[model samples]
Target: MSNIIEIKNITKEFKVLNRREGLKGSLKDLFSRDYKIVRAVDNISMNITQGEIVGYLGPNGAGKSTTIKMMTGILEPTSGEILVDGCIPYKNRTRNAQNIGVVFGQRTQLWWALPLVESFKILKDIYGVTDKDYKDMLELYQSLVDIEPLLHKPVRQMSLGQRTLSDILAAFLHNPKIVFLDEPTIGLDVSMKAKIRTLIHALNKEKNTTVILTTHDMGDVDALCRRIVIIDKGKMLYDNDIEHLKGFFGYYRTLKIRVSGSLSETAEKIAAEFPEFSVSANDEWISVLVDEAKSTVMDVLSQLQKTYKIRDMQLEEISTEEVIKKIYEEGVK
Candidate 1:
């Protein structure tokens, strides 16, 4: 696939007033000219392919929003280049806007007092979308989310999940080639979140829409993205496939087993057998650190069952948050 979004060594800096502490300092600040340059995004570069769902992630204050704003032409970068589709986003915002869609979870683009469908009609007129195109787009979106009931509901009266769902539909109404989704599932119920994820997945699959999803939700990343570009302190830390990122953190998984009795001896024997694994035992409960590449969970259980009566066994993969936490702690090693 061709690269639809290319950002090369982009840097975005902002100048803010440097206010001093205390009443005296505050008085001085009224007459004094003090400023500081903050680099929200510093020398970050990434390429997102057409039809690829890329998770653009970072902790709070990690410049994730800055980068997205630059990409969407909301903020111009301090230096370097950003190419979305074929044009520089800031230079050709109108064209870029036509080619791409955006959804910010905390904000709504719909008219507060207008019926949801009325908002859609206004957008259709603004975008100059043909009636047939609007119908087709609505059909595709309706298949994923039941927007029929929402059509007549006033935006202000809609629930958070309902309003968010409407916002998502608005974003894709124009059938843009690329979409930028920022915390699209934030504050949503579990079922609503699942519904949104399923809709996003279907949109990507059917339309081959390029997506750059900025979110802290790991489940969102795992369910919708294959590749992840992680940033920290305004710098690109890790940009690779999800599995590769996991491997970079080393094999981190836990296998727990319950034996009838005397778990200490079993734990020791297992630890000795797999010297690399860290093992612990508390009564009948035993936990082992496992690298699936080296030994399968079933293999460990099979070996243990040979002597001890296996009461139960369970396997758990390292959570996505833990993987990101390690990245933040280690800093792109």
Candidate 2:
């Protein structure tokens, strides 16, 4: 597939008024303006292909939102270029809108007083969707979302999950080539989040819809996105497949093993032999940090099984969220 979105050395800068102290500063600001320039998005670039789900991530005040706004044509960039399906979004917003969809979880595009179906009707008109196409799209989404019953309900009366799902459905109603979902599952229950993730995956898999998802939820990234672009302080930190990101810190994995026979005796011997590994035991569970570079989990487990009866074991790799947090706190060297 070809590149559906291309961002080349993009930057967005804002000028904020500098004010003095208290009422004096407030009143002086009306007559004279002293402004400071802030770079919300520094020079950053990435390419996304068709039928790909890319996670655009960053901490608060990072350039993630500014980049999204530029891509969706909501804000013009300070410099560089952005092409969505070969058209500059800010330059050809109306034409570009026809080929793309957007869903902001914290905000709603649907009319508050209007029934869900009515809002869709307005969108259908705005997009110039054909009767056959609209019906077919609704049918496809209904199978994935089970939103048929909520079609006639007022958007204001619906729960957050219902409204978010409705927003997702509306985004894909026109069968756009690309969709931008910003925090689509925020503030949702576990079940509802799963449902929404399923819906998003189905849209990308069944219809080949390209997706750009910006979220703090690692689960959403894990479930739907294979490739991710992480940014901080308006700069790109990492852009690669999920596995590659994980591999950056894949040298160690935490192992929690439950041993039934002679807990204290087994723990003492295990710790004695593998003093190089950080080993500890508490409540019949042996916790060890297995260094993948030096020793494997299988090697550790095999040694333990021979010494004691090992009932069960659970291995956990460093979570994606934790890795991202580390990058945000300390520069990814």
Candidate 3:
């Protein structure tokens, strides 16, 4: 399959002004600014194929947002290239916007006072949709999202869940080939988040739309994306299948045990022994971190049981969230 999006050696930099202590210093900075160039997005490259849903992840100020902004034509790159459907996003923004849709979680593209249907109608006109295409697109989304009841309600009056559903529908109304969703499930309840995930999956399967999802929610990543690209401090850390990413860091496992009393000493000893694993404790409950490659969960539990009375025990595979956390914490050195 052809790549729907290609980013090559992309970098973005911003001039940050240094300001000294007080109100007087703030005023001085306005006229005589001492600027430091901050690299918001360092040299990065990735190719996203058609009909694929990619999870883009990073901590705060990790340049995930800066990369997305550059891809969507909201910000021009300081250097390098971004191509969406074979057109340069920054240089040919109008042409690029016609083929792509973007949703920033903190912002809404729909009109607040208008009803959901009205907002979609405005978008349909904006994109110059034909009557037949408009009807088919609306029907397809209404069935996929089940937004019939929410459509008549004004956007401001609807709940967050309702508005989010409507907003996603609005983005797809133009039948864009690719969509960029930034925190699409942010601030949603568990049920609502599930619903959105289902809708996204259905959209990809039925319409073959390429999706680039940027989210802090690991649940979203686990549910929706087969491939994930991780970024930190403006650098691309890893880009591969989810399973491969987990195996690459093979330093995670969960150890749960019930021991006599608090077992604080044992917990402290275990933590001290394995500095790589983080440890936690509760009354009569001791949990130790186990690196699968270093020590199996069974081995750790058996050793602990010999040292202390163990009533109950369980082992869990490390979660994607924990793996990502370890990667960032350890700096992939």
User: Which ranking of candidates, highest lDDT first?
Assistant: 2, 1, 3
Instruction: Write candidate 3's Cα lDDT for 306-333 as tens digits.
Output: 7678888877788899888877777676
TM-scores for all candidates: the values are: 0.84, 0.84, 0.95
**Poorest 10 consecutive residues by lDDT, candidate 2:** 245-254
Please give, for residues 22-132, the per-residue lDDT of candidate 1 as tens digits.
Answer: 999999999987889999999999888899999999989999999999999989999999999879999999999998989989899899999999999999998889999
Q: What RMSD does model 1 have?
A: 4.1
Q: Is candidate 1 or candidate 3 better by TM-score?
A: 3
Against the correct fold, how does model 1 do in TM-score? 0.84
The Cα error of candidate 3 at residue 7, in Å, is 0.9
The 0-to-1 C-alpha lDDT of every candidate, in the order given, reads 0.89, 0.89, 0.86
lDDT of 3 at 12: 97
